[model samples]
Target: MPIKSIKVRLGLLSIIVLTGTMKTLGQANDTLLIRQLAPVTVSATRLEINEKRLPAALTVLGGGRIQIGQPQLSLFESLGGVAGLFAQNPDNFSQDLRISIRGFGARAAFGIRGIRLVIDGIPESTPDGQADVDNLDMGAMRRLEVMRGPSSGLFGNAAGGILNFQTENANEMSLLEGQVTVGSYGLRSYRFKTGVQKKKFQYVFIATRNQSEGYRALSHMESTILNLKLRYDFDSLTRISILANYGNSPVADDPGGLTLQQATENRRQAHPNNMRFLAGESVAQGRVGITFEKTMGKHLIFARAFGTKRDFANYLAFQAAGAGTINRTFAGASFQYQFSQKFDLIGYRFRLGMDVESQGDTRRRFDNLIGERGKLTFDQLESFKNIAAYVTQELTYQKVTMLVGLRSDAIRLHATDYFLTDGDQSGKRQFSRLNPSVGISLEASSKVNIYTNLGTSFETPTMSELSNNPTGTGGFNPDLNPQQAVNYEIGAKTYFSQRLRTDVALFDVEVKDELVPYQITGQAGRVFYRNAGRSRRQGVELSLNAVLAKGLTLFSNYTYSDFRYREYQTTTGKFDGNVLPGIPKHAAQAELRYFTPVGIFAIAQVRHASLLYADDANAVTANGYTVVNLRVGGQKTWGRMHIEPFIGVNNLLDAAYFQNVQINASANRYFEPSQGRFWFGGVKVGIK
Candidate 1:
């Protein structure tokens, strides 16, 4: 479909919706009151506190909204309405997904960087700030808390912001549920969940399997996930909890990017080299974690420990080193104590904590002979260690709150080479820093909050970024230094009435030595990192939720990002004042949903983005596009069973665009065409 036609249709539909329903209340008054009165949050301060009192830009997505008539295939589906956040690459399972918050993580070449990912208090990202969520099962997630802007003062390294995912705990009522779904591109999924509760014990188990013959050629993917959680309540003041998870992805093909001419010819065709070499990845990962919490008198104590292991193998076309195999082991622990006191009308809370984590990887690279390994090319052992201590204080004085925090971290990297035929190259590096932040929040009224914060953050290059140097070095790149930045932000969350609510935020960030990647000559798939002199980032975000009519709700979010380099010079040319690559300057998303008394529900969503640059030079551009999607579903209750049937159509207007782009890609191949219009339908059965 033409861009103009898509826009006109969407504009017409939106006008019709706005005119048809504009006189109804949002959720029940009681439910709204309960949610607004004392909603709790833990990600901002690392402790439970009222959401209105947190001096930071935070948003929470409840489970009900996340899973309502959704495919649950990627986080993009759940977080599309969040302001200042962008999720991409949902169709390319080989690379998982790309997430950028306020343009902080837009420089990533592969995997996640410059952000922290936490699940149930366990870090999914490595110490060096690299994360992959291919194994994450969205079915069991209960809630997500997103902390925007800089947060390293409390969370240590790579804390540009935090993505915290909380899992559902076993409830007092025993329950069992199962679901099966089939979708376009031969997609299929099955999931099962069960929970049990007793006097002193509770347990929950979840399992999921997903497979797809992807929309594009040579893009098949299959994965299985399992999770188990157990809790024992020794007493009212003490509790012990344990969690275990395992994931396996035997195959996830990499279709590779296509040039403009190629994409124009056939959007569904795979790169010729990718198909000839059978480029793909295979992965297995497992983790176990335990937590103990207790309260004694006026003091509270918390302790946690965790261990994880991963095995990964991948084949790439035209590889310099060869096929690769990586075995990684990671372990971490944390301890914290909190004290609270009250005097007259003032309340005080003091928290002190420490975290320690270590990771080691045994990496082997071999020459690629088409789809098979030809010979051993490189072998190395790489390790990273991090230790940090932090303290936070909160003061509450009648309708106002103040938060201050300080942290110190030490990180070390080590590498050992075993390929003696080349040379015995061993190297080590150490980095340490101290960060602090302060913020204040004011409750202007019963339904309004104003908050502001200032903080410092530092991010070190991940091992992959440091190891692959264009100069063909075997060890870490000594030229690359950690990036540092300072952030300033102000925001407000206001409820106009039971019918409407909104969140608005403005942020400014100044960065020094920003890490940037450049493609190496003759290495078609290789990239190297260098530090830019300085950079500036500023943005505004707004999100709204409103009730248009009795059973109709409207949600919309918009972001305006003005990000560029203040001083940067490359061998090719100067890039000062050029827009950052891979991020759009203007983006907006809107959705309208309706519910009926008979349990029928329908939703329509529209997403739009402005043009974006493909490289630091600003020579290549990817045009903006608009996409529309629609879904309808209903539930029916039987004597002992409940059934829900749903159907979804994506890209209803058949917009032609790229779902993912390779930033600064070599050879002018950058676009990864998005899947065209597709349809999916499924039914779920369970006891209600």
Candidate 2:
């Protein structure tokens, strides 16, 4: 269908919905019983806080809400409608989905940058607050909260924001849930979860196995994951929890970006001969934590401590049938204390926290020489440590609330180069920064609230930027300073008749000495890192949720952004004044759902994104595309068994488009295409 027709149809649908609201409401009330539900969130702070009352822009997705959407493949793709956030599926389910919050980390293909990710109060991101959630199982989650804007003063290095995932707990005695799905492309998946709770002791185990032939040729993947959680409460005020996860997956090679003509010619075929490449990743992680809470009359004290470790391995295939592997290890600890009413100040809350993290990575590059040829190998190692402390206070006076926070971070880094012609050597670098933030909330009325915030954040250079061998590219930079940014935001939240909720926010960020990676046209195009003179980013975000009469819900969001380099030199260091790459000028989403008797549900979603440049030089631009999706599902209960079957259609209109592009060394403009129209159906069953 043409874009014009799609828009016309959407308009017609909207008109029909509005015209028949009363009738539909009556039918919905008679056919399906529904009730008003309160919004749930946890990301505003470490504690459970009402989202409406929080002095920030927050988005929450409850477990039931997510499951109702019947997401077949990537969880990120399922959340494409969030304001100021974009989720892209480059190629079917073979690769990690690309997620960007306010265009902060769109460059990374396998991992997330400039954002902090946490699960069940344990930091899932690396020492610098970067994370990869490719292995996370959304089925076992209770809620997902997204906090946007500057948050370094609260979580440390979360320049963009934070994603907090809370897992389901065994609040009952025994429960067992499982799902088995089979769909197009030879896709098959199995998820099993079971938990037992007895008094103060509770345990839950989850396992998943998935395999797919993918929507494209040679794009096949197989992954297995296991998660275990155990919790014990020694007393009413003390608790201990332990969690572990292990995952492994083999991925197909990138088909390389395609042009418009190429995408139309062969939507299911990858680049010729690309099947010879093979790569995979594996992860092992675990965490142990304890919480203590005590109350004395008007005073309350809360404390927590946690230790975590993550191990990673990555293998890449290169030319001459040679291969290389990268290994990384991370360990961290955190401590926090919260004191309430310490001085009898009404509605006063104070919190202090500290964190320490150590990380190291080793890379081994090798080549397979021909017969009678000698094999060559080289190795490099890099290590880094980060320490941070923060303090926060919140005071509520009547309908006005104020929050103030301050944080300090210290970083130490070291690099050791071995197997080099110059012999073994070591280098060190250090950096520190202090950040502060303040926010205010005013309750304009019983159904409306206004909020404003001003905050500062800093981003430290990654180990890859500091110590990676630059011989092939431009050689590593031994001296790199942390980037600093100031963010300002204003927003308002309004609730209408307790049925409709809306939020609108405007924000701008200015960065000084921003680190940017660029390529130099000297000695085979070497890649190096440099700091941009300056940059500015501004945007507006709007989100709305409506619970219409009769088991119907509507959610919509839109964002408009203006990102550019304020002062940059193109000649001296290959940096020029240009629009930042990968950031869309405009994005929007709309979703509608209807619930019916017999436990049946139907949903439709539409998404749109504007054009964006592919490279820093602005020589190539990728055309934006709009997509539509549809889903239908039903559930039935039979005695001790319950079964739910769902079917979903993505890219319903089959609009062929590219998500990103870049100028590669081959002088070819490679583009990553969005997934074509695909269909999937699955069933989930539960046993008690």
Q: Give the Cα lDDT of each candidate.
A: 0.83, 0.67
Tell me the tens digit of each residue's lDDT in model 2 across 108-192. 4446677788887777777754676656877767677888887888877746787888777887312887877655566677888
Consecutive 10-residue window with the lowest summed lDDT within model 1: 21-30
Report model 2's TM-score to 2 decimal places: 0.87
* Candidate 1 vs. true structure, TM-score: 0.94
Which 10 consecutive positions of candidate 2 have the poorest summed lDDT? 519-528
Estimate the TM-score of every prediction. 0.94, 0.87
RMSD of each: 5.2, 6.2
Best by lDDT: 1
lDDT of each residue in 111-159, candidate 1, tens digit only: 7778889888888989988888887888889888888888898888888
Could you tell me how far off, in angstroms, the CA of residue 372 lies in candidate 2 after the best superposition? 17
In model 2, pairs of residues that clash are: 257-671, 470-475, 473-526, 569-575, 570-575
How many Å off is the CA of 673 in candidate 1?
1.0
